[model samples]
Target: MTDRQWADWHRPQQHYLIEPRYLAGGGDIRHATEFLRASGWKDRSKTGGPLVFHNPDKLVRVVFDPLAQPGGWTVEGRATADRPSWEARFGTGTPVEIIAGLTDALTQQPTAHAPNVWAPLGTHGWEARRGQHVTAVSPDKSAFVQFHQSSPGQAHWWIGARTEHGRAWDAHLSPTTPLSLVQALTTALSDPRPVMRPLGNVPPSDRIRSTSVSVTPAQLGAWQQARLTAARTAMWARSAWTAARPRNRHPATAAPRVPAGHTTGRR
Candidate 1:
């Protein structure tokens, strides 16, 4: 058999799926944070506490605190007098790309219909079990998505992806987290396109469990150039939006002063 056919025969189906950098998890925190900043989310981080960002209207907030229990990264959309609120969290071990999936949805315009999280997982041959709570596992058994009750009248969702060595990443979303954001993350996780990664960067355990495709230097360079072009296009869009909006002189948008007696360090 040719190398391509042989590799496909031995490879786990999930390996053939395209893994976008954002959904692949374990990306640099700066990518997501920078995107938010460019999209007009103000940085309101305190010197010692976790870094914080808030939307211009103050309805949405994102926090990065390595010290926080359960999750180091938290995103919250506060309820207004006429609206409800929502929250999503990610452990320090969670991928920054997965976190960005939510932020991307939050900053973008809404869609007419919600994206289907369960259907895509099912379509990809993930097994679903329903009882007190619902859980889905990828065919290769390296990934999972779950929804369960956290308390009376409280429900939450959890997603985790791992390698043979150990857990790679995980995230949590409260029941109130917007369905659109939830769909964005699920869609990313279940996409069936191959993700490009340097062979050297693949974890040893993952290499054992997945098939790696060789890409010529020229091909890799082209892929990188395409990504750069897309990023530049997004940057230009954000710049235009910023220029068009009226500058908010509200005191809330002003740079916050460090409070006395506050020392910055992970609790």
Candidate 2:
């Protein structure tokens, strides 16, 4: 991390994921890293396979554009150019349970955005890591969430949410450490430009109440009377005005616009 005085990073941050498939007896760690990297995550420890690949920047790239191999996800570019972001998408399951799994494994406080939108951490792509790493067991009804980066002139990723599907996320790669990814992220996160905004619609404020409509019987009677009076007056003037009014089929309607340097009808 850049250690710049002006840099912005959330202190004491902790993030975690829970994959039941990872904890199985036949589980492979390298296979996991491969799947995650393709989307954009990388590991520094080089701990074989799907051990622990943490880093906000790398995680974002992998999340959006994951390199899907036959087995697991792989690490590729740190979704820096693409506004990198992460989304904890669930597949028809309990969000609280999913978050609970991550919290239990990582020993951190896990919150939710809605049903699938989990709690957020870090500024740009920085994640606060703590607690011991554990394997995740993928459920039968797989809850495949993703962390992706957004494209340029498209700041939607930083503000909105992202989703991942079947084969799209299961890509893999050779066992590689995400060291550089973390380093890059640390530098980026140090000097933060945090913009606090709501995920979707900025919910209406509690202080603002819809104004009461004025629909008294007297008002309705008065309005109807006014309308009748105006209609009678317009009926009397309609015939006189219609005599001189131009028709919709007039020749001028089909005329082309004159060129900038030229004159028209006078010639």
Candidate 3:
């Protein structure tokens, strides 16, 4: 095996070691879904269908379906039942981390200085144009974002990263999709910082578009050792805290636990 591949084999699964990349591949959806649950979104999914979540005010809804086509995950915000406000859709291949960017924005209050989607791309030497439609392309011409009118009164937005082999990831947004969400997506896309990844694990297509930076074995070892030491120290501290905590002499009766099972619910 190659030296870099050897290092990847030895690296711990949870280690912080990473390489920067313009577009990272697909990631687990749990992160985004968990974030929504923690952020006060109510789960309203049915047993045999897609996972659905709604904000407390019921004005926003998120749906995730592993089997859905074109877009497996969708988010929609509406002012009323009859009148829709905005919508965003993410293909199955889109990374959860990217999806979280939009979800995070949804939960927070809007800022005065919203992020500029086109400015950053232009600053990074990406081509940007405005006229009948707004569009931007990465310096390498492998990634792009476009906004245009699909039809009268209907707007469409698309963002995608790809290589010669195939598409890396992409997202679609409707006319009313919040500008903040669009900015969140563009911010991530235009970030100068690279995403770390094991050289051996990277797909061949991605390697063609990426600029690899070699990290010495010594540096990798040092980073791993530091993480191990920190983890052990944290564990020891936790153990000590647990041992020192006082235990109740007489514990109260625990409430009956509900059996785990799926329940049917309306979306």
lDDT tens digits, residues 1-267, model 3?
Answer: 898888775655422222224455555466577666755678999999999999766888989997866657898887554344777888776656677778756655455563455665666666765555667777677777787656776668888877677877778887556565677777767666645455554555634345555665556567656644544454456456658874211111121111223221211
> Which candidate has the highest TM-score of all?
1
Model 2 lDDT per residue over 5-103, tens place? 223332222212222211111122222233333323344543343334553233322221112233222223333332232233211112222222321
CA lDDT, candidate 1, residue 64: 92
**TM-score of every model versus the real structure:** 0.66, 0.16, 0.64
Worst 10 residues of 2 by lDDT: 249-258
Q: lDDT for model 2, please.
A: 0.25
Worst 10 residues of 3 by lDDT: 249-258
Model 1 misplaced regions, further than 4 Å:
1-25, 67-71, 150-152, 194-201, 207-267
lDDT, residue 134, model 3:
63
Question: Of the candidates numbered 1 and 2, which has the greater lDDT value?
Answer: 1
- Ranking by lDDT, best first? 1, 3, 2
Q: List clashing residue pairs in candidate 3.
A: 18-196, 19-195, 19-196, 19-197, 20-194, 20-195, 21-195
Per TM-score, what order, best first? Answer: 1, 3, 2
Stretches of model 2 off by over 4 angstroms after superposition: 1-26, 46-52, 56-113, 116-267
